[model samples]
Target: MKKKKMDDQHFDKTIKGRLENFEGPDFDPTALADLRYRLASITTAPWYARYRTELIVISALLFFTLFNVLWQSQVEVNREQSFIQVMDSLKTSQRIIIDLQQRLSALRRITSDSSNASSKPMTPMAEGKLNEVDNLLSQLLEEKGNNDPSVIALLGQVSEFLRSEPGMNGDQSPPATPLSLLPSATYHFPLPASSDSARISLDQVTLKENGGTAEAKEKHLTAAMARELKKHFQKGVGIRLGPAASLSAITYSPGPRVPSVGGGLMSDWILSPSLSMETGIIYAPRFYDREGSTMMELQNLPGVDESLGSLKEVDITSQVVQFPLNLKLYVPLSRRTEGVLGGGYSFLLYLRQDLEYGYQFNDDFDGRFQGLKSTYEQAKPRFYPGTLNLSAGTSTLLKNDARLEFSLYYQYGLGDSGLEQVKANSFGLRTAYWFTIR
Candidate 1:
């Protein structure tokens, strides 16, 4: 029992001696207090304070989405209203043409009866009424070229009656009234002869006035209406080619700028005089530069303690294509020039990538040395697949139904570039040559 007690006391003395020789970790009391204060403040902070940046970004996106949808709906409504107005105008013009035809028919009937009863002596009152009808018919025919089918039929009937009249049997010609006095250039129907047996052919009915044929006048009017309608609607296809400059690295990283070239085919639709939409596929050849180094520990020989750290350099290059849809608002600056503001979305289509890795030792302490290098080429999946863009530009009308446009634009990537924490942003100039159809 006494020996057990002595051994326990000796163990206690050895533990105390070791404690006296040990050293505790270096620490600052003030730093500990500060850390505790910071933790407590974070716990008591509002939720919005913790996620303020995320909340702002989400709110901005929601507002932009809502505004775009409402604007498109309103534009559609306006387009419908404009179409209705044009159709109404055409209907009203058709009704007026029908009324004119009815008046022409009634005059033709009365004149035909008068010519047939010419063998009977005419009283002064009857002759006056006939003259008045002839004057009204002449005025209606001269005001405009009546191409209505009903008017043409009535004219044919009048010509037949004049040819069959009994008064035309002798050398005595018809009375010198307005209808008989019409110039050859003013009438599209054959005139009656002094003899009943005299015949007239349909080919002799063509009217020419001021060196312009009836057919020519009709064509002119049709062309005028087409031009007027084109002022309200336009559609076209265009080809665009331009130089582009872009950020070659991930967003927030130092840009290694590179030159790029692009070209595309686009379809454009003008919803109104001032609003339009465009969509197309673009083939853009893009390039990126990445220069980085990594540190790795190296052993001079197998199972040896002596070692050195090595540095590795990595470089990468890529090429891609893009598809975009855009909306544009136009403000007329002159008869042939306009200022435009636009916004849109795009999708990326990746093609190929080249990666190179090179490594070397920091110091050549050992006589033996090693150099390692590798290169790989691969087809890439769709990378940085989505982007949003904004643009401002001007367009100038050119000859032969063509236009020239110039714009400056900024694009913001909405997805990663197939790499962690990497996005894209770019600014560029675009020029397009467009052909318009209406």
Candidate 2:
């Protein structure tokens, strides 16, 4: 505000300075005679002279108030922008911390091998295995670039842990169970030692669609054969899902739109900001004349609402419930920010997908029509149980660490007709708040 005031004052001075700098012609024309006549005629008004000072004071006060209000608005706008920027940075920092934590956890989870020890009185092979272990230790304690002393120190601790773990020929007992669930990361030796051998394998999924055009000779799936061969070696494995998921949420595709006027109209009416309520059923049976169901949604029927106007019935209402399988990726954008993009497909319903199932259909009588006549057939929930996103957000803190965000996204239904695809744009806001990440 202080800077704004100073700027305004400087701008006013600059404007007046330019006006004062003008030098007029050194000739007096007939303009002075006309001015004299105008001055002689202006003395008739009396209210102007009495209220002149009061009007000047009032005008100055109004200007000051307007100037202050505008300045405050600008400040708020700047704060919001800065918050958004800081959010990106915070997201990036969060990603780095996560990567570091994962690395630390992997080091902690590593198991030792007692069978690899030299059984034959420390032969050349045993020496080679020891050399390999030494190399691994060097890698574990190596400095991370030039900075990040904590990460380097953590690596050193991991090296000490590895050294403490049992070696070959020591006859130490092995872990009761092996790590069979998580994917094991491998480190390259570059040049393998004389006695020790290393092998790697994938444990998760076998791909069916992962084929390059070049791999497919004359439209034949050559990559399929390659995958089949690779399965024996297990270079890349399929992923496994746990009985309990790590994260889950609800999201939808782009749905129908409501046009508004005068004030907040269509969006407020159809796409409810509040939880939707169903009155028996709100669809007409004939609307489903195309496919899938027999009975329609009933609204304002014999035992329904007193009003039969906008309240109508559908032919039938059918909902397809499904739990989604998601493939998620966290992309680091900068120092403290990250971009989240994930996609998946599933027709299996989980208990958590209740709201997602409800989201496929909606009906509002009082919410849509008020004083005007309009068409209602176009807004019915006809198709559902398609693909949808559970959560998608971009969290970032460009360089700063202060930003918060809120968003609203939804779709009325996923229609099957050709024309319905064009209506797939819905409401969502990308917002941000400000804060620092620890």
Candidate 3:
């Protein structure tokens, strides 16, 4: 036991002597460079890497919004195309009806002249038949009631043509001359063999007989025309709904121009072709960073030099929300685009505020001035009328009749931002796409 203790004591003394005699490794200048390189790699990470989650969320939202707009546009395109087709068919039918009327009128004049030339001007029944045909023709040509005429009015005139004609030889073909209504062609009607002069017709023409099909087509065309006329002449109010985004910054000389990004919904009431009134709620998350120097006085304090007021830098950051009302006018730029001019009012609602006060000479205070930050959770006057905004922009009409708009705007603060001498003015660029609700 005595021998073991002596050996342990000798071991401890040997270790102490070795420590006193040992020299540390020589200093390497490359160590400072390696430390600096490590710090730079950590601090200079790519912006996208730092905000990858935020960027993904934003991208997903944008994709959803775009998909919705495209779906709505496709629906409108289909409806508008169908409407155009109906209008075209109605126009063609109108032209055909007018042509038929003109031809009937010419035939009537020819028969009248032929009757006057014949040796018999007698028969009151024949004259009455001619007058009946004339009345039916007039009804068919009347503007307001033209499309509303019944099958009887249309086919009855053809029957009237058959009956009202003067007695004719069976072998004769009437009127070989081209009618002005159909300037491209001439029509000849054969007088059928009949013993009775009052009645003339024993087959050959199918149009007068197939009244049902003709009536159906006429009814369809008439309905379409009516709908087209209503859409064209009716005075109706319209609304437009859309999403908008803005890159905004507050206007102040002392404040650093920290960019603010926000998006929100907007709606416009189209009062006329050229004018609109707009209103909407916007979730505008804005960051305001202001940094400047202010005079600070430090009177006699322990371990502090007494001096006059010295310049000290301070920084503040505020977050705000805005709501706006606008009136706008549109001027035609092209077949599918318009130029916009607008003015508006906005109400600002401050949500939170943060301030950092730094002492310029506080390094001498043994790190006491570090981490000097104040955060205010309560908003002072919750909401106030904020700014008067002026805007200019252009809107392009999409295939679905919706519009894509790009704008530049300036907002002049109507009130202060609760920061001393700092107004809440801002300027920004905005983009929106709107669809009309009729």
Candidate 4:
């Protein structure tokens, strides 16, 4: 009897194993259960003693496993798509920032231009409008869209776009035809476009018209963009114009940073030396991290205001001096001109000189000075160890990778930094430069 029961159990196990093997794409547990139920019902022989619900449950479990794998595949696909979208956003924001920086720097020159080079007189409103346009351009460029491009390309696109945007005619009202767009006007510089190829130039555009037939004006805007692009390229900001095609309003060859936790060293590097100039911000200071705590605490501070140490019996919290950081980002022009922006840690060591001591005892009381020999030491005890620095260097490149770099170096204090009263906290110099042997 035992042997016969064992044989029956083995047959049932074989049948269940065969049923569990079948699966379909995007396996639906509900569908599998129904299939198993139907199969069990079709083979319902009373002597067979079919466990119909058990078969269906086992089939559903197998299908669920298959469905889980498909769901995971979809998750992986979604993650990849999300990663791509983030990277695109970073590139776009980076481009917009770079564009706006270049734009405002150009506008500053147009407004402050004292060259008296242009024959036409610039109106105050026109100048104000130029500034406004700059602001608007900057704002629009930040948002990633199909229209965004370099200033020249962007202007051309803008002119084309405005043709479909029916604008108000100074009456603070919408146009009659919403679909039919009006064209914007382009503003030339106060000076005539010069023939000299040595100088640089910049062109301003106006979205409003000074004359009729705005459609023809839109086509002319393209010409304006080309002209400006040529000028900006050859002469830099407000420099002279070269041939229209000579200068490409491009972000050089660099596209974007590689997205990795620690990206591998660049595989290929391209160098193109031109008489190119640009204006942008850079990291002038070392990013602070808690990597060097022990070494930092022992150092002295530069430009510590002594006024705070002497205010025991007086109200002089307002007299405390805090030195703010200032940075300069230069645009390079020619092999002779250069710009730099870098930040790093600085350790201000002890002053290499003796201290000059003078104190005012009271207001306008004529008193003789004396160095009283107390137990207190007269010299500074602590050495000024400066923290990380943010620096920029502009220079003219010379022979054999040697360029004379004029640096704007800022030494920021980490723990004990303060401005020395009645003294300049920072100084600029036309410093020397040494290129790294790569």
Candidate 5:
């Protein structure tokens, strides 16, 4: 063995010496340098570069969602603007009638006081004023269907006064009041019994013939009306509708707890800026299992006096309808977000209950048997007294006058669950999307 080892070492030395002295054909230094550079350039790519495709897909989805929200917001704004314009037009008509009433009253007083004045040659300015008033009255009378009874009566009075002028037969017209010089204050005159029945303040009505041009005054009034309407809308009552979902589990029951899922419609009525009332219905499908009592059936056996134990289990499935009513208080959390706390009651209706039983016999029995199963169903509808509900949530405003909400809730059963004296409490998370209506 030692001689073989020495021979191996001598052979390795001879090969090493021969290789060290050997020489091959010359190689290009440039080619070797290029190969080394290429090897050094290879490296693992960054995570972002490797996952660029997934990132692009996610970004596209986000962009689409944002665009859709923007479009819906624009639509809501346009609709509100259009409604404001319609209201402004109606208000303008009401203001015009009130203005005419005031001028008519002033003209009647003047006619009564000057009834005994002496006749004189009509001045050019007075004639022009009379013509203007007559033309305005004629224009109003032409549309008899649109004029109120009071307006028609005032027009008639004016016509009579014009005809009975003190100097009409002597090529003259009586002194008259200019429309612009009429009182620009509130008057207590009866209006038509309609939506515009309430008396209007003259100060609120922009005087077209006063300071600025009619067009400019009209635009200003429109902007002012819009602002007022928007303010009222913000502070006034509102309503919303949305779908809700929850994940819940039962407590203090004979059965093992399970996950319950369902969805339903929910609505809220804003009673004030920071307070609201909520009511809705939810449909829930539930499943649970409880340990069952042992039962035994056997033929004549040797030592067994009466019976033997058999494994038994019961599974329950139910469909329930929940009616919840709550009062929620809101506090602002940010520019577009709010935190809410609520307490209320939930009424439950059991639509269906299905109980399934299974039995497995022990092999100690000589009788040939495997397992037995049975199903019992109750179709009668019943009510589960009620439950007290408490919740905490956050609401985020969306672009289109809508809101998104996420909440955590707890419910304490007020009475028995009507299932073998089972009383249960439940807690879960809930989410809802809501839209606003004013």
Candidate 6:
């Protein structure tokens, strides 16, 4: 035990001497400070350098999307404003034309009353005033052209008056030509004279049928002449036939965007000097070629995977019939050409549709499949009932009473049409040839 104690004491001294000779690693605050500085520098680096490529691409995409949206919005707003301005201008022009027409009618009534009066012959002063008025009218006709209905009517009345004047026939003797032989150019003639002076004037005029008094006979002759003149003007009706091409789209909704081409027949009638009516029938057919890759899954087959799919191609065709009734305003642009503005209602008579789908299989189990096809037909009150249309065009009168007309028209469907919730909005070009009926 005493020797073990001496050895343990010697080992303890040896371990203590070794611990005194051994030097541990020196602690430095600067090392910890250097590490913290490096970490902070990395965090404080420029944002662009940290996320350069990703940020650039995201910013570019966002800018492009924003620019596109703003440009499209600006274009739509400008278009709407322009359309409104045009409609307002049209309304104003129409009002001015109507006012001018009323003024012309009043002037014609005054002149007719003076001419039909059975007073003493026109004095030299009065005749000179009439001559000045006539000269002024001729100058206006030369400047404004013969297309003005008011001018034409006034000229016709002047010519009729010259023929009817008692002593203007270059013969002292009573005129041999009857009043019926003169063309009636006025729309409304002076009523038969009620006073004694009017009766005496009527007595001076002779008619073929003398059964009634001079006044009655004169009235009958005037009536016949008016009817004949009306018939002559009404004969200017025209029949038009043409081909039309249209590009149709849906607005305020989603639909198939397609163009339709067709032909039509129409009849135009002159209701008045400046107003006309047209009725027509149009048949248009549209074709849609839509092809895309679609994955269609197959099921319910033994030894076949449920995940099997195929690609498909879709195609559709449709047809529509339209009937239009329109009123056109004629604004003479020249002797042979006129500008036309019109609006009307259109009836969608019928619609026929066809769809075809073809499938190409990707899996060997199914291979290629046969196509599927379908057809449908719809008529008025079931699909589209009617639409409103606006048109602007020009017509040029050609030789032999034929006319060439070219127009651009826009149509807006009043309600939904077809099997889907779709309405037709279209703009079209129409060219027509019309032959006047004699």
Task: Return the top candidate by lDDT.
Answer: 5
Instruction: Residues 233-351, candidate 3: write the lDDT tens digits.
Output: 33677788887888887666445566777776788887766788988766565454433432222112122222312324344555556788999998766546779999989888776
By lDDT, rank the candidates, best first: 5, 3, 6, 1, 4, 2
lDDT of each: 0.51, 0.32, 0.58, 0.33, 0.64, 0.52
lDDT for residue 311 in candidate 5, whole number 0-100: 38
- TM, every model: 0.42, 0.21, 0.53, 0.21, 0.46, 0.40
Candidate 4 whole-model C-alpha lDDT, 0 to 1: 0.33
Model 1 residue pairs with clashes: none
Model 5 weakest 10-residue run by lDDT: 297-306
lDDT of 6 by residue, 250-295 (tens): 3423434676655555678777535789887766654544345322
Q: Which ten residues in a row are the worst by lDDT in model 1?
A: 190-199
Tens-digit lDDT track for model 1 on 97-151?
A: 3333333343343445455443545445445544544554555455324553434
On the 0 to 100 scale, the lDDT of residue 437 in model 3 is 65
lDDT of 5 by residue, 168-277 (tens): 44444445655666555554323443333433445555556644122213333433343334334454577887667788877755445677766677889988657889
Worst 10 residues of 3 by lDDT: 196-205
Cα RMSD to native, each candidate?
17.5, 29.1, 16.1, 35.8, 19.7, 23.4
Which structure among the candidates has the greatest TM-score? 3
Report how far off residue 170 is in candidate 4 (Å). Answer: 73
User: What residue pairs are clashing in model 6?
Assistant: none
Model 2: per-residue Cα lDDT over 40-129, one tens digit each:
888676877734543554455446445544544454334335434543432333233333333334333432444553433434543443
Error of 6 at 96 (Å): 35
Candidate 3 clashes between residue pairs 3 or more apart in a chain or in different chains: none
Tell how far residue 149 is off in model 3, in angstroms: 13
